[model samples]
Target chain A: MSANPVSRARLFGSAAIVITTLAALIAAVLSIGPSGLVWAGIIGAVALGYAALSFVLHLSYPDAAEAAWDEQNTVAHRDSLIFGFWAVLWVFLVFLALSLTGRMDPAMAFYWLGPVLGAVPPAHYVVSVLRGRAE
Target chain B: MTTKLIVHLRVYRAQAKLTQAELANLIGVSRKTINTIENGVFTPSTTLALTLAKALNCSVHDLFALPE
Candidate 1:
């Protein structure tokens, strides 16, 4: 079957958003000195711009747009949330186990949690698409 | 677990001369959703099934069925 242009666009948009977000995050984390706040602001602006562009694309494609974007997104969003919850729980469990065994610092457990949370939805989306389990 | 649904979406879509994207647009869903449903990779919710049926000018039962 031929590729659907709208789906391709969505994929491209999602990829751009995810890649940019990750890059910004990595940059922010690595440059956590005096320039950290500046990197954070850049990340926020980049993310906001990417989000706005996606919204504008949706507005431009009436046929491609949802009757209700939130409604249409509900199922996928729900799935992503569930997956993210489980993923975070798993990480927490591992952290707990490590702490109990004195192999990890309890205070450091949550240091990576934010990044883990950020990774979940995109990871879920990619896995779902690969497995053909996407809705 | 896989659903018990059987899909005849592609056949009907072909008969109607509609591409996956066209059918998806008609039903207000993503083309990926339509593609997955057509390939039996995903089971659509009842609301979506009905919407697709209505778009194709058929009943839900006409597009989907259980194995005999």
Candidate 2:
């Protein structure tokens, strides 16, 4: 099969994580006395660090599978950073609406969909890693 | 980066326990896509990778490999 753009998914996944993490921090700051948000910030920092490292690894190794980082692929990284902001805003608006309606717990602020997206089978990812292919 | 070793088309498909048709159906793509990927003529998208990885129950690393 001709290779399709694999970066887009990477972009989406990383963006989603960053956005969710940021939202968690913000919510923690505004509501639960900055401590939780501070910790969340720490986690965000860690995630960002890993993201950067992944990028470098991908560039240097290219074919290295673990180098297939969360938001590291060259093309995908940009998309994730840009789209991440937008996705978070969308999520924020959603949370805002929920808050106003008093329909859900504010703690729902964590990145929910990111993990649930486990809908995509892990088996294929493993295959891609071993095969040195994007997908 | 250096050029790396890659899997044989047949090996990868078998490892995923996927017939080309089954994988294509799951990904909402055509079997031709799977066949191409299997033949080393195709590279999948990041989205497709995640989908495949998720189904395979392993990290993308396990699926794709680098040359020694």
Candidate 3:
């Protein structure tokens, strides 16, 4: 409701994502009854869900007469995107590595490419937003 | 080498089988924001553009295109 509440929204959104992801990771680890990548993959899936959740939450602003962010929000947008892209890339590489360890088939790893590619643009957009690198 | 944002958010939203409120809920933005965007009252930033693009199952260029 503040005239400039983007930062607050972002902070709250980020907190929600971090908490949810961490909680999921803990839950997966505790429930698995074993110390291994099975739980790790579960954690990764939850993190991925929360990352998408953060974006959905960002879309919930109430102003029909206003845009999602203010004029200065491009920098934040770009930064988010850049971070997201790197995170996805890192996670994908790690997943590929894990799959190759003989637990999962290499071809199965390709299944993750969709989500990984999907995240890159948003991450890059975040980076660009933070850098004021609008088009 | 080229940059253009032509389609605009309004047009894309119209194609997505969503009212402003429906789309707003999906994107976590207010209906007012959705309405404003549809009316060309404001332009979405890069983050928003990506989110909307994802939700609508289209490219950013599909939602926004370069000027002719």
Candidate 4:
């Protein structure tokens, strides 16, 4: 059986992500020291790996990729955003409390918040999709 | 009167002799969208309902109803 052609949009999106992430990694590492290089390396590796995997999935399973972009998935995405909002709010509250008590550095809390914001929505989205598939 | 949205998409699609994927393609959506609508996991927009009805050769009222 012939494999379905991959979506051009998906291909270009993956390529863009990979390119932007690499550029950001190089800029960060050049501007910062070894510590920043370590963090940037980890983040860059994850971004690159995810982009590659997404591209491969779009290429290998065109039907599933198409399914993931439809209305049901949009509903799932909105639900995940709601979930992420509450989750991040709770995280912010916790960090605020810790900073108020002088238990955590405000700078550190602010630093970690960026990753929390980036991670929560996609994590919730993945979970929501998995739950929907299971049901 | 209290009413709940009731969907009969599966029945209509079956009567129309179309699979979920086929119905989705007819309506320019994905199979999972049709599956979720059929299983009551997702409530489609009015536009989607109308499109589905058009594709299935039925009315929206035939595919969905609000029961009192």
Best by TM-score: 1
Off by over 4 Å in 1: A1-49, A55-63, A67-74, B1-3
TM, every model: 0.71, 0.30, 0.36, 0.69
Kindly report the docking quality category of candidate 3.
incorrect
2 or 4: which has the higher lDDT? 4
Q: Mind sharing the TM-score for model 4?
A: 0.69
Question: Which 10-residue span in candidate 1 chain A carries the lowest summed lDDT?
Answer: A1-10
Q: Which pairs of residues collide in candidate 4?
A: none
lDDT for position A83 in model 2 = 54
Clashes of 3: 45
Pairs of residues at least 3 apart in sequence or in different chains that clash in candidate 1: none
| Model 2 residue A80 lDDT score | 34
Q: What fraction of the true interface contacts does model 1 reproduce?
A: 0.37
How much lDDT does candidate 1 score? 0.67
Cα deviation of A49 in candidate 1 (Å)?
4.8
Comparing 2 and 3 on lDDT, the stronger one = 3
Give one digit per residue, the lDDT tens place, for model 2 in A22-111. Answer: 555566558754565465565557556556755664566553333233322333334434554566567677877887799856665444
- In candidate 4 the C-alpha lDDT for residue A57 amounts to 78
What does candidate 3 score on TM?
Answer: 0.36
Off by over 4 Å in 4: A1-37, A48-67, A133-135, B1-3
Model 3 lDDT per residue over A111-131, tens place? 545444544454455344343
**Per-residue alpha-carbon lDDT of candidate 4 for residues A1-135, written as tens digits (9 for 90 to 100):** 111233333333334443544454465548653454466466556656666867887777767566556666677667767877888799999999999999998986786565566556666654554565311
- Of the pair 1 and 3, which is ahead by lDDT? 1
**Runs in model 2 with CA error above 4 Å?**
A1-34, A62-90, A101-135, B1-36, B39-68
**lDDT tens per residue, model 1, A1-135:** 114334445445445545755775676558644354454465456556656766776777655445323233456657877988999899999999999999888876765565457556765655555565543
